[model samples]
Target: MQLTVPDFVGFVGVALVVGTYFLSQMGRMDVRKPLYPGLNGIGAILILYSLSNTFNAASFVIEVFWLVISAAGLIRALLLKSR
Candidate 1:
């Protein structure tokens, strides 16, 4: 099977998300930092975009929640910084 642009995008998203997690585990990334959530949000969005062309219920649900959670984390970080 041949890979498409969306597939590449989805792979990049997976890499970003997984890399962030790996960094966090290695103490190179702080979970509370905006960068962490921002990466996650962007990655989730990319994955969602890919999913738009080939939908999967479970994957879609998880990505939706991941995006939502990342958004919440980013918002919380911003609010904290503002205070």
Candidate 2:
């Protein structure tokens, strides 16, 4: 099968999310840092945008939660950093 732009976006998003998890698992990433949530948020948004092109209910639902949670964490991290 040929790859579309949306599919490529989804793959990049998957890589970002999975890479973050790998770093976290290896103790190389700090969850408390803004970068963590920021990357995850970006990844989730990319995946969601891709989903908008393909329309997967289950993936869409989970990505929505992931995006929301990531946004919350990013906000918290930023607030902490400002202080």
- Top candidate on TM-score is 2
Q: Candidate 2 lDDT, tens digit per residue, 16-48? A: 999998999899999999999999999999999
Q: Which candidate is the best by lDDT?
A: 2
What's each prediction's TM-score?
0.95, 0.96
RMSD over all Cα atoms, model 1: 0.8
What lDDT tens digits, residue by residue, belong to model 1 across residues 8-63? 89989998889999999999999988999999999999999889778899999999
Ten-residue segment with the worst summed lDDT in candidate 2? 45-54
Clashes of each: 0, 0
Clashes of 1: 0
